[model samples]
Target: MDIEMKKYLTLLLSGMSLIGCASSDDLSLKQNILPLQTEVCCESASHFPWFRLQQNQDLDFELNASSPVNQFDGSKSYFSAFTFAQQSGLVEIRLRSLMLDGEVAIPQVELLDSEFNVVKTIDDAFTVKFSDAFAKNRYELTEKVDTVKTPYMIVYVKTSELGKKVVVPHPAKIRAQESGEPMPIVTDPTYLASNNGHFSLSVETITLSGYNQKSLVEAKPEEVAVVQKPAQPAIQAIPETQSYYHNAIRQAVESNNIDKALSLLDEAKALNIEGAQEVFVRAVNAK
Candidate 1:
């Protein structure tokens, strides 16, 4: 082969090798904690199915979990999450875990100030659960008053077992319950001032595997679109009954007869006409 051809082929092969390695790295697995917006606590393992927080709420303590099956081979890691909003005076928390052995395993919890010094250490029985199974046990830690100026709280756990204590792979997140009842919905500006303050929890989870660059890969085939015949146009038809009801609804809305509009909406919904519910909800919410 010519010298120029040989040099070009060597460069091409090197590029292909790098591309393959990158693709493999992309497919490699990792763990991550999906952060919650508003603060909410995980009431139980059953709640893990679709646990999340609201838009305006925040969390004081949160558990960010990964899929249990995705846990590292021998690394017994702990997740330390923090709250978003600042708080003064006393901050409280309740801890509970799935029983590992015969006795209930008390996970070590520390309340730290802004400088990471241990402000308070808590390991005590504060509440009781009726269930004995790991799934049924409830751990409680309350009345953790700290004098520090930090806005974050850390809850960490590591296994004492020599080997990996293989619990279900999914990481579980929990938060301290709110102290007061939620504020009621207020529609008027004047009435809004009477609404009391509502507190929320903030929890964040970070996955160690997501940081591994070697396992990141980018190997995938680009999509190739194939055009086909367009869909057949259907007849734009309206039944006589529906036409009459639509006209009546339009007239009622124009006349500002809300009851008549609602009654028409109920009839239209029962008929299950296309766009009936959408139009109805729009009318109802408009007022």
Candidate 2:
């Protein structure tokens, strides 16, 4: 072959090899994609089938077109119901949804009593987090529930979250960046808001003993009577007493007299002292 023809063929073969590598990478990603749900809608909340949640065990499920649609706050969306098999003291529940395949599920929770009455509603609690092991992003929410009052919970998508998108670094691009590749292909793939995706829920029982003992103390009848005594007349602070009030609050907090420090704070406010609130907060936080 002539020298010019040989040079042209070499360049053409190199270009084809690059194109083949890119195609292979795209196919590999599609092949390893996680499977999504294809079921129908669940029943209404009152008669909905609830999956039993066991302590310290993780349960995974999906919400799709088959998931039940319910009206909440005047908007319709899909939901899932769950009930604890056994609970005691305070239980911590952790919920997470995977952001995969350009879709994500934004979840809110409603805690219900035995009569199916709403006890507590939780929203805007899920925060985006990354998982290195799975090379994927997830939205996670961790909340403590009092099992005595609320034993049932429902996971649902809020109306406000619909059409919202979560921007995440593409896993393949992240790998390229981490490998120190020059001119690495970088893309911020967005996961669209959806009521369909994979999620996992886990529960852990918390011991009451871990709480502060002072907060659990109840006042006796005699103590209540003592507290009901007439209050002393308020002593107004003189003008230009800002420094005095600040020092007094710091001293009280240093002595572990939180009540006295708060009383000083109220007195300072009554005197229209500017920056008194900031000083009081700083003192308390320092303690």
Candidate 3:
């Protein structure tokens, strides 16, 4: 080979050798600056965590204590999506929705195109649980492969007691529009103690060494508003008694009117009915 070509080959080999010797610290420095696909976990103090896998990465995300799904890790499940570093390749991602005591049966996934067409859907997945009490857990992860498209992808997950559903849209890139608003970024999850009976959804995220994923703090999932029906009034039963005052109070109790019962008791006491005071006090205490 010519002397010039020989030098070029030598330099190329040396550069590869230097990369092979790069440490974890060196890799962190290059993160976001370059899309290197590895297991990126959420730090303990991370408030909002959601990230997109690079084109070179083969979907390597899982939920655990150290690498929790999100801010509300232990008690709630999490869901989020990130843009693919590239614009034209086909990649797949999995959504794992967790529940406490019992496993959630159907974990539906709807993939929509830019025009909002349902391109793919998953109806159900098997329930999984940990054997040990320390596990005290139940989880439902999508077993099917979700085809993630370029330009963007959408993820839908179910969570909480009634299986509240959420829709997440992940765009291909973070373009700072004139309004300076970024869509589908992390949202602060509600804090609640971990319960074996509550279902939770969460997503993990990380910051590349120099890469800033545009996040809008106010962005939240467009969840369906839940309307809570008012609780039915308790039907208070009257105690069987021969005393007139007691009977009057019982009538009020049966009608589920605390105010009427108290009023009747006061009248009975004013009339100097024997034991009226004691009966009234008892009814009020019972209520």
Return the TM-score for candidate 3, rounded to 2 decimals. 0.26
Query: On residues 122-239, what C-alpha lDDT tens digit does candidate 2 reach at each position?
Result: 8877888876774358998889987666767888776576557789776676676789766456677787676556787778878442223212111111100011232342344433
- Please report the candidate that would top TM-score against the real structure: 2
lDDT of 1 by residue, 1-287 (tens): 34653454355445545544553223211111111111222332122111121112323332222111111123332233333123233344334543323223234444555444455545554343433333253344444443223333434332232122223211221111233544444331110110011112223222111122112112111000102221231223235334434544544443344455555556566555466545544433333
- Model 2 ranges off by over 4 Å: 1-44, 170-185, 207-287
Candidate 2 local lDDT, residue 230: 24
Q: Rank the candidates by lDDT, best first.
A: 2, 3, 1
What C-alpha lDDT does candidate 1 achieve relative to the native structure?
0.32
User: Residue 51 of model 3: what lDDT?
Assistant: 40
Residue-wise C-alpha lDDT for candidate 3, range 147-228, written one tens digit per residue: 2332233333232332332222222112324346665455422211121122232322222222332222221111111122
- TM-score-wise, the better of 1 and 3 is 1
